[model samples]
Target: MNYGMVFLSIISNRFFDLLDVLNKLNELKLFTLFINIKEILLDLRIPKSKQMRTLEQWFEEYAVSHQNPKNKAIHYVCVPAIFFSIVGLLMSIPSGFIANTLKLNAPIIENWAVVVLLFVLVFYIRLSVAMAIKIAIFSAICLVANYYIGQVFPLWIFSIGVFVIAWIGQFYGHNIEGKKPSFLKDLQFLMIGPAWVVENLFSKK
Candidate 1:
């Protein structure tokens, strides 16, 4: 006679029916399909905070080692320079093999740097979409600059020169800060450094 009992019975029946369907899927050698669906449901049940670190959290940790004004100022300059140089170095690598292997015809997306940056963008996206977009814009600019520089000079040599000098400056700044670079603790902070720099440049806060 209870309405609540009727509702519970209906829900239980539907739940069991769904489980039976899932079991059939597994028996049919579609175990992967069942596992993927299970994983998706589990992922949805997990809270966002438990899934990944937020952009603010990454920046907060990065800021710990970059506290001193000298360190902060140096980072403002050196981070972008280091990022640019790495991109230039990547672009200098021949992409003919990658292009041939992938059967790609697009000139714009054929460079090694572009291929690498796509993965980098994925990392940024996992932290924050806004961060991803910002890094993408900066990466495009680096690509353009490297393109022009490669036309007139050896990009690999230029990148190596800038990379060495920038690291020297970075170490000096960290010495002034009296803290080690954040990447020493975890290599992921290497990617975080550029995001932190971009946030500082664009964010009013």
Candidate 2:
């Protein structure tokens, strides 16, 4: 009898036996369940890559109702419209008193819109840095547009009119989608809506 070959055969048999038991457990669908239970009972740490990926997935999932082609197209136009209208409306408001008090009188681009955009960017930055930067650039364009809109027309009146019309388009889009807006469930989705729109310009990878 060759002792080394005998020991190797014994080890191979034990390995095959373990694999057989695992295969049987897998057929019963208990292998994963048992491991999960074991982890829970033992308070073991499970890796979190799946959850990390799902966090990004929430943006697309939350925007599911807007997936309809017409609805999405409408959002592409209306979300920015509603956003810039609000910014214009706010910029039209006289923050001159606050500016005077704080001595922040830069005369252009330092107004209620700038103040509000600062706070809004905080919310976006917490979600994604790239998104926050995109929003800032968008806000800058809106500021310039606000100046132009104010130059050509009554800023508040024009902004309010656009705001109302843009929102009407939004509800109409949702009507086409056969679902309510996600912001109705949680207002954070209001911010996520813009992020979803901006992120579409980039690839999934």
The numbered model that scores best in TM-score is 1
| Location of the lowest summed lDDT over 10 successive residues in candidate 2 | 46-55
Model 2 residue 34 lDDT score: 84
Name model 2 segments beyond 4 Å from true.
1-55, 102-105, 202-205
The candidate maximizing lDDT is 1
Local distance difference test, per candidate? 0.88, 0.82
Provide the global lDDT of candidate 2 against the true structure: 0.82
Compared with the true structure, what per-residue lDDT tens digits does model 1 show for residues 47-96? 65634788899899899998888899999999999999999888888889
How does each model score on TM-score? 0.72, 0.69
Please provide the root mean square deviation of candidate 2 (C-alpha atoms, Å). 16.0
